[model samples]
Target: MDTSTWIGIFSVSASAMCMGIGSIAPALSEGKALQQALSSIAQQPDEAGTISRTLFIGLAMIESIAIYCLVVAIVLIFANPFWNHVIAKPGG
Candidate 1:
């Protein structure tokens, strides 16, 4: 109803949506990557070392995306720029 209340609602909704989508993507990616890595290792047991090393690096990179999304969601929910603006308005 009020400007501040609206901003708070919007911020929370945005953060929840961001975190939900962000987490899903990375979860799917990690699952697929793990499946592929296992397949590769199965096909070439001798190259397990190299394949495993590469897999770990790739996993870390994929995980970073989720981490970034989490941070963004947290910022949006707890430290939203829009919140400051709305709260600062007269009679907010």
Candidate 2:
């Protein structure tokens, strides 16, 4: 295949790999955060509201990492900067 085709394949493969692997840490972090929050709540029932609120905010922050990864993957697969360079070549 040509360079562009190979680039496309590689981009898609890398994007898929990024999304598949990038999500793991955030998932684990969110799970762990929730676990700790629950444990804290159990230990201090009166502070449940504060713990729950902090947990949700922390979860949202953690989730943003995955969202960023997804954005990067989408950009790689659908709007790759290399594609522009390849397409802009005089002989392309």
Best by TM-score: 2
In model 2, pairs of residues that clash are none
lDDT of 1 by residue, 23-66 (tens): 99899999999999999999999999999999999999999999
Cα TM-score of candidate 2 = 0.87
Predicted candidate 2 versus true structure: per-residue lDDT over 33-53, tens digit per residue: 999999999999999999999
Worst 10 residues of 1 by lDDT: 83-92
Clashes of 1: 0
Prediction 1 global C-alpha lDDT: 0.91
Pairs that collide in candidate 1 are none
Candidate 2 structure lDDT = 0.94
Candidate 1 Cα deviation (angstroms), residue 24: 1.8
